[model samples]
Target: MNRLHPLSAVTYAIQYGFLWLWVPIVLVLALGGIFDPISPAWSPIAAPLGFLAGAAYGIAYYYRFEYGITPDTFDVASGVFARRSREIPYGRIQNVDVRQGVLQRLLGLAIVSIETAGGGNTEASLNFVSESEANRLQDQIRRRTAYVKEQRRTKQRSANEGEQQGSQRPTEPDADSSDADRTGAVSGAETDTPSDPTAVPPDRADRTDPDSTPVDGEEPDAERRAYASEPDRQRRQRLFDLQARELLLYSFTSFRPAAVAAVLFVFFLATDPIIDLLVATAQPVGGPQEIGEGTATNYGILTVVSMINGIVITYLLSVAYTFATYYDFELGRTGEDFVYERGLLQRYSGSIPVEKVQSVTVTANPLQRLIGYAGLWVETAGYGPESSGGSQSAVPLAEQSRVHRFTENLTDVETPTFRSPPTMARRRYLVRYSLVAAVIVAAVFGLAQVTALEGWYFAAVVFVAVPPAAHLKYVHIGYFVGENHLVVRSGFWQRRTTVIPYYRIQTVSTRRSIFQRRLGLASLVIDTASSRTFFWGTPTIYDVDLEDAREAHTAGRKRLQSALRERARDDDLGLTVDFT
Candidate 1:
């Protein structure tokens, strides 16, 4: 090891302590098969190996760990044997997220997370830096990114002499002085050498200039200036005030449903054991009703009833958990980025650069259908197979108009006309499929025997309920292809709509199952990364609610087919997409 930082020693120590706690587990395995025998051959060999294994954890974290901010990259290098480095260009950084778990908070430390497009693997964490240092680092990164952007711009404009010029951009902070200071600084640099501003190396200038201004009217220089800006701490404080607007936007979005689902799922899983316990206790002893257990006594119907009771309790618990975690979710706009932050306990924050967004999807469930609530998701790129969520959503659910404006404002593109799915034409498919379901329900009622009122009654119930429900889901299934993007919206009870950026599409496949194939209908699956509309970021939704809906949505879908297919499709349709 070259050397360890002062804190590396503590970090290593903690790693070792945690590793040592695994001793019992290792000991158990050893005793089960090998550790017990103290043979001359085994004792000497095993002892050293075991000691080394135990010691590796601490040495490993220390040796593998690294963190630094390079001029072009903010990087974290770690991983013992595999050796991984997450280095993101200052330009690639989308945002900075900071958090402090209870332990870190107690230690007065903050963990800084750097967010980048397609750079999720890094979830790169700082061991624990002082809270103030963490903030400073974040601010510093913003500064460096701005400075670097400036350097690139200057390079672009200075062309043939770029190499010599960019190499000398100033390193000093932007001198935020009055006109007097600006003039003085320019003159001061000149006094030192008297070189023309254009002649000065861009790199040297960026390195030295705290407040560097771009030359007037040059395109490349203007672009960089557009992206980079000095930090204004005051604006950071205003972020809180914008939180409410974000929350309002998030309320109707699919994020709310997804969050609700996730929390409920966690709680449902957690409470299952308790429900099982309750059911076990509720059962009667002995008799014909009892289950086989240590007790020989039989119980009455109480066991089954208790289980039902338990299920009820578990469901309620899950609902409660949903309410708790996503109680006040927020998703809003800040400058050119969309911010998403939520959670009552385990809070999470994320952002999307307006340019990185690929598409959006909207959906709804039966409940949402009644309430005029819907969910929306946005898709972007740089996320692939290993991504945590396949579907990247923006606002999971929102009122229709709000969702439109959200998409419109975020993209700075016109909201293409919204087309509700064909209610009757598509209803044909749902009705046909639901007919099968109605038959099944009728069969069940037939076996139960009352077959008179119950017969017509059950069949009528099925015939009426199934198609209506299915139609609701189908009729709402529609998609829209806009200037630069595409959207697919569907769902009756639990409605969902997804918007995907054409730029981010990886693949689009049209599939047909045996049933659908027989029906001459097919479902189109658009594969993408974590999308705001995707449930848990999963890119696929099942069973086409509309046979022709896919056809109607083909323009955007074809964009993802193949290089040739995309070109041909766009050519045929004459789509003029502006790539930023």
Candidate 2:
């Protein structure tokens, strides 16, 4: 039995980081000495007592997650006394996921998840376990179901072969094939047996046997042999099954707004500097006395411990928290669609049928670029702005070559390359960004000059630099459509693009800033199932653009509506004609 879920290491790290599960409560007891400054019992008794209790609770709470699957169903049961179990039939299983967090990657644990056909809730969850086991389980379940299907298919094929061969009885499997089917069940078994699992070719040896004879009403031996796969064909099939296993857990990536939002958490921490500045100015103390006292050193100390320490810890923990919270990631492919299951606490999952995919996009972040990795996004319809917010996705990071190869392999179509507008076309965008930055900087500079916030602090105002930042941000913008996919790429250091399908677009909306209006350009807003916005009517988060923005915005929704109406109209006309 595997002792841990793949997610075990990551979850425990999170428990300690986010909840301070390991930091002993005795730290508080030790603080009593500081406040009292006279207490002597704090060390020998209070500290140990507090530490012991805290450590106990921490250890107990750390192991509270359980997840796995049995032969019949996949499930996860966790929590102390009050446990929850979610199980789904093997056939109904739509997706099974294996995920590795930063810590889990190091510890080599993986969390396995199963998604059913339709759900607005988490159907099953496994907290942590061995990565290999989770993978094996995933393969096992997929195989069990697929193998059963193949078995039925093989049986059907045999029957068809029987019909084609005109055989009275189906062919019996050899001992080796049966054993192989038992071990490989779903996928591998298909190979050991033949692709046409059902057909039976009558043995010619029986015709020569002294005691063997065909039963009455049975077909001729020649007809029975006609339905079976030739020796060469069977060999080819075995090789194909072995080869296809590489595509088993097929890799996936989508434009992750959740990740982007989480990354933008930097802005949240950056706000504290502004607050500190305000507090410093508003304080009446430290006027002239600061020159004689250690106020400068005190500020430096505060910067080192309070500002730097808090910010660094917050940033590190934020990344961990975000991964645990949002990228509770999963990816799997079904009949004609690719499904992505992600998010923490409250899970969110979205699936995109390949036919509906509007585009495939590739992008890179500075950190990722250095290592030759990039982010990928898929844009689709029925969930994007046309309905309310345009549906788009950013997903699994991958190497450029891996993405290219997977695209071609999965779709069975040569990958299509989409080209964007000329770089010069974006000159106006720089102007727009420059003007916006200028307005902000000028206002801040004006306020500083008028308020005397600092004496001749003219040099410090260089922080108002905007032209370079805005220009860099503009250079990264690219938008294009390829095959059935619509793609858009933007962002400066961390480039990103979204590939949304035409039909997954639930809604589409457009927004325009007054400045953009002045330039005779409108912004196109695209939104998807970003959890932050799943309400009715307008979407909460969308991209704003200024092109054929308005018309292109509703293109998907209008097309769908027209198709549905036409379908309805066609059905009604048939009813009125009453040809039957």
TM-score of 1: 0.60
In model 2, where do residues sit more than 4 Å from their true spots?
A: 1-87, 91-122, 126-136, 144-292, 295-361, 367-373, 377-464, 527-547, 550-580
What is the C-alpha lDDT profile of model 1 across 1-580, one tens digit per residue? 1223446547666666556655645555566475445333444445445545645666677767777655567767877768887777877775666565556656666667776666444456666666555654565565565555445544443443344457787676566668787888766643453232222243533442323433454453353344344322323312222234334433433223344455457557888775455545664432242244433223334545655664555555555554444445555543344555555544444455544555555555555555565555555555422145434445545565665565555454455565553344355566676778777776776755752223345455555666566765566666555665666666554555565556456666777667665555556666654433243344443455454546644665555554334433332211111111
Model 1: number of backbone collisions: 89
Cα RMSD (angstroms) for every candidate in the order listed: 11.7, 16.3
| Tens-digit lDDT string for candidate 2 (1-580) | 1235434544555454435432334464556657877355544555455545544444554465544444445555555457665666655664456665666657766666665544323466556656555554554454444434445545655455445457565577676677666567645533455432222122432331222344454454432343232321222111011011121111211132444455447547787675465345433433222323445434434344445444444555555554543343545443234545554443443444343344445566666666666644444433331123223343355556765454444333334353443343355656666677666667767766775334334534444555566566655655443333345566656565555444334556666666656555554555543322242222211223455565566565675465445433332111110001
TM-score per candidate, in order?
0.60, 0.44
TM-score of 2: 0.44
Candidate 1 minimal-lDDT segment of 10 residues: 571-580
lDDT of 1 at 173: 57
Write down the worst ten-residue block by lDDT for model 2: 571-580
